[model samples]
Target: MTTAPGPAYRSAPTTFGAVARHGRAWLPVIGLTALASSAVSLALPSVLGHSVDAIVAGSGYGRWFTIAAVLIGVGVLCSLIDAFAGTACVAGTTAWLRHGLVSQVVRGGAEGSREFDSGDLVSRVSGNASDAAQAGPAAVTTVAATAPPIGSLVLLALIDPWLAVAFFGGVILVVGVLFVFARRTAEISLSYQQTQGRISALLTEAVTGLRTIASAGTTTREERRILGFLPELHRHGLETWKVLARSGAQAAIVGPLVLVAVLAVGGLQLVDGRITPGELFAASQYAVLGAGLGSLTGVIGEIARARAGIQRAAEVFAIDKVAHGLLPLPPGPGRLTFDGVTVVADDAVLLENIHLELPGGATIAVVGPSGAGKSVLASLAARLRDPSIGQVLLDGVPLPALNHHALRTAVGCAFERPTLVGTTVGDAISHDAIGPVRTLAAARATHAHDFVRRLPDGYFTPLPKAPMSGGERQRLGLARAWPASRLLVLDDATSSLDTATELQISKTLTEDRYRRTRLIVTHRTATAARADLVVWLDGGRVRGVGSHQDLWQDASYREVFG
Candidate 1:
């Protein structure tokens, strides 16, 4: 089931704004530290100029000594503050962004509209989030960098208007260069990020499919395909370097010219007795300050790259989370109902006019031919996905109306090929179980306890070291899902098991304590025949609903299993 996405839930789009919103607790530290650092930086040159005047005057040594002490003290303080603030901001922002990205992806579910490959999603969570984390420090550093230029301009004007004029002219040219650099770098950086994501996707695909590739004797072909993305990545990277080089060269050229201009003008003023020797020294220092500040073009470049990364991360946040209603379901039997439900994807109608009203504690087998919507219907029943056009209800309450905990606890699912997540077999089976006894009981019911106990450490053995076949893995998945409160969905979950084991498992499910609404999707005639009722689906529509014997009377139905 799919629909146009709802409103996006996210912080601000701009990197700085996002950091500010997410890491507000650290903002005070960042702002205060940057201000102190910039103030100390601006004071150093003026104090040095004063010390030079004192030296030439043969004034008391105490003045120079105090200046040196002050300089050391402020420099130490500034460095400490900068270190603390930058580190805190980066760590905080990274945690915040990763939490938001992971939450969005997980809540969206397997059948939801927001989908990304494992590699691309990993890139966003790790690489892109790391890049976005720099927003906090970049903003602070830009503030610190601006202080020197503004202070120099004011001091230069005070010393001689002509000196200030010459410095400002060069600054204008540098600013222009940086503006162009930022724009060009932004484009290249986005392309670079996208290409990197593509390469990661290709590599991840190749690794996951390594066995298939090796068996098919196409390892070299897969390798070539993965490598093909490198040239595009290299080209984008080169474009970024070109922009940086042009900006660096222009800044370097302008820096020296500005220094010379300031020195020449100050020397003439000194010769004319328009300014003292100390004043001329101060003018030279101001020129260096102005040029040094222009180095913040480097920061601007970082901001551009950070913006590109943050933009990619923002795309992850923009994916709408699954919509849930406020109403909660009352505890009772899982009477499943689908009212005029429809499922569509990419403009193709997969299921149409699905209407079902099944009683609680019944084993309802959903049997269908290939291309039928059996799996889709099972997904709707478990609320793994919602219907596009109508509602799926549990005990007359819409699935979305139940809170996540209520819904998840009430309806559990097992898939044919399950990807379990845990180091030990015990952890994998009881990852979300209510008690260890319940976990053990579920495992025994699914016929996994015998094999699990045969392993070296019983259930404590690590899953990776304890080898198992496909059928064993499927049994474990079924055991893990055996604790559902009201409903259990098995979407061809036992397809790998032998007929005897599958029948035993099915018999266990129908026992007294295990009685619940069961929606089993299967192709086997025996499995369907055992169900209390069978829902026969064909070509995305419900063809019949009755006992397995009644449905078997139709030749087309018998042909499904044949």
Candidate 2:
């Protein structure tokens, strides 16, 4: 399911300085290359002015012309280096941010990360992350960009103090225009990104439920609703260009005034013989370099976008990660206990005051009507989510107190809709802590070995090339979970299978020699009947806990299966 961004979406603030700091070793490369580019730019004007003087004097001018050409070549080479370094820096930082975001989301787990929509998280990771990586390179390059203008001012002053004074006036106005642009673009870009994320979320939700929409004949309504934010996105996009255009207009008016002022002042100095023709030409070149602030509008805009990206990424970073203790689990059968466990979301209690204990090495079926918190109890049994009010313990050790490896190695879970992620069908079952040793046995146990062997390459077949029905995928999920030695939780994991396959799999679960605790959340009366004990739940409270036959004697308990 997808959700719209609410007021608490961006609760944490991300700073530009913080983002730039992430560049680490890459920052120095970008800075050095950009400074080299600036140095070459500053040297070129002087070399060209000297070449003009040598030509006018009718002396040998080849040396000066060659020097000017070399300077230009050096400038181009430095620019190329700067570009390459900037690209590498952005690439590295994007990977870093993506890794951090993904790790954070995974650490939070499904229940903890429920506040975010899948599409929105995708947009942030792929799109906003790239934009955020620009912070380091953009900051370094923008700073280096200042060198040329400042160098021009110094050169203009040496040519004639009046030219420096004239260029400085335009610099002031250029700075003002840039300041306004940076501030305005930051606000508008953030809004644009938010709207874009919203559209992505709605589109993802629609795609996920595409079949429902088609069957209900509501595709038109869905399309309209998904695109509802387009107008707002369009308006924000237009404003970004409007801001750029307005700044360019201001620069156009102010830029020429500075160049004209320098030339006008330098011409008088030349007429008075206070400065040479070459010096006046040099002054004009300096004026052009110093007043070319309009050219940097694009760079400034990128910096603004980077800021917005950092802010958006901070939202994910702010999510509280599931923390585990350093202690390991001790040897015992998976004796599970729920002490006054409760789970509440948005003031609605899903599970309330669940205080019960299930002995080790028992196959227990958690049976209840829909919304009776059956799945919730199963999740608690596996410690996938911590109880809001009380702690869940395994073998008398609090689940949260155990370290990550200790807990994960002990429990395995299979879900109704399992996503098999690996390069090959065999690889997915062998993925995670399950390992390859049990892959074959687990497959055979779940009755998936035959269909898997029929594939073109058998276990070696790639996941994309190996097509599977819903039940087949579920069996693979069970195979993946089979390596657990302490507890196994099947949350409607076999629901897609036919009754015969389901019955066969159920027998394997009960009669297996491993003797580990098995918690099965199922709606089928057959599954409950096969369990050593049935945890009959109604309205989130335990109605009874005993043999299935004993609970079946109650008419209300029979209606739960109905």
Candidate 3:
């Protein structure tokens, strides 16, 4: 199967549209509420203009008082509506964005697509998604809020076109300034976010390898490397703020200047009888409304940043590829075959032109020197990685064609470095399908049962909260895997165990009681001695395949053994 494309190439709308469809009901509600709120806010200035006109006309005191009271009431009502709508929009968008991001991460899978970087994926899912969540509601609300001011501008133009022209002109200038600065702000913000992700990944790697760093006396140097990224992050933040600050100053200074200019021109018009006092007052109020609209420049900047975040999030959701096998295997007790298979990675052939067959209820040992690709060969048989050429089959069917989950269920692997789950030893082995057999059974097989039983809670004991020795962890890892999979693959799994323990486990696995195919990848001559067949690999090719004694008699095999 072809590998999936990376996150960068996928269409953003596919992801955004999916989120919107899922959140349609709430999104519309937020938009409608915001529209209503903006309408109410727009009414306030109109009502105030009416009240001022009434006072100027020498209307009854009670009439002017009533208009003022109505304006105040409308202002209060709009504030409440704005608060409620803002809260709903923010809460709904946050929930949707978080949910969508999580779904994307899950579907992307743990092994990840070859094209996507794990560090970048982490940052997009965790940090960029958060930024989108925080910004979505405000951005939606701002767009909604723009509508009423636009409508009011139309109404103002009908009242007096010259004043309307001034309002539009001022808005254009402010918007132009905002757009220019917004681009710079967005670029810097994206850089900062990407850098932060890289820093986090570096820290995670350092922490996970703390022992190695400490042992090598390289902790200080590693720390300094991490610290070095901070200056770059700081510089990006500073640059973004500088651009934003300059844009904000321009908006602040220009908005009031436009308002003052409009007011002065309107006053001159009123004196010249081109309009009434009430008309001039209304026009000035409209100018202020336009100024309020201009303030959305700051909101526009926020939106630019949010758009960058959305793009980042979109990149993560784009990765649709995962490693998969190209063929299927027929169902039966696990019978494995390697048909002229070769494995290559990083332009180096690790396993080449190897042919082998492992029948059900049989044990085979794969013997090779280090870097001979014995483990790589075993992993291919289990379909961990596809063969560079040729095919591996299970039960007469190609391995890749088997359903991935089913294939994994049929095959279990115990790595050279074992991995255990859960804290308590009993917790680790309690539910293993092999039996309710205590941790001791598994530990004893690998000679870990004794040391574990001596701990405070014995089989019920928990591992230390801190890190443990590699060998101890590996033993526990094997104990966990041994009982879980039907077709067991032990890739140097017993390397940590003493010779006696390794022999015991090997003997137990060889018995009819196990009744499973076992592929042991090891360097131990004793392990090969116990196998029904020994496949010797050398320089990525099959050097020999036969009983250990048969290979021992061959000149090539004897030379290596000697």
Q: Provide TM-scores for the models.
A: 0.94, 0.92, 0.84
Q: CA lDDT of each candidate?
A: 0.81, 0.87, 0.69
- The C-alpha stretches of model 3 lying farther than 4 A from their native spots are 1-22, 58-121, 134-139, 320-331, 344-349, 423-467, 553-562
Compute the lDDT for candidate 1.
Answer: 0.81
Give the distance in Å from residue 185's predicted Cα in candidate 2 to where it truly belongs: 1.3
Q: In what order do the candidates fall by lDDT, top score first? A: 2, 1, 3
Superior by lDDT: candidate 2 or candidate 3: 2
What lDDT score goes with residue 398 in model 1?
A: 81
Q: After aligning candidate 1 to the native by TM-score, how far in Å is the CA of 542 from where it should be?
A: 1.0
Number of backbone collisions per candidate: 0, 0, 6
Q: Which candidate achieves the best TM-score against the true structure?
A: 1
Error of 1 at 22 (Å): 3.3
lDDT (Cα, tens digit) per residue for candidate 2, span 163-183: 889889889999899899889
User: Distance from true position, residue 419, model 1, in Å?
Assistant: 1.3
Residue 250 Cα positional deviation in candidate 3, in Å, after optimal superposition: 1.6
Candidate closest to the true structure, highest lDDT = 2
Model 3: worst 10 consecutive residues (lDDT sum): 1-10
Over 209-238, each residue of candidate 1 has an lDDT whose tens digit, in order, gives 888999999988998899998889888988
Regions of candidate 2 where Cα sits further than 4 Å from its true position: 1-14, 60-63, 433-437
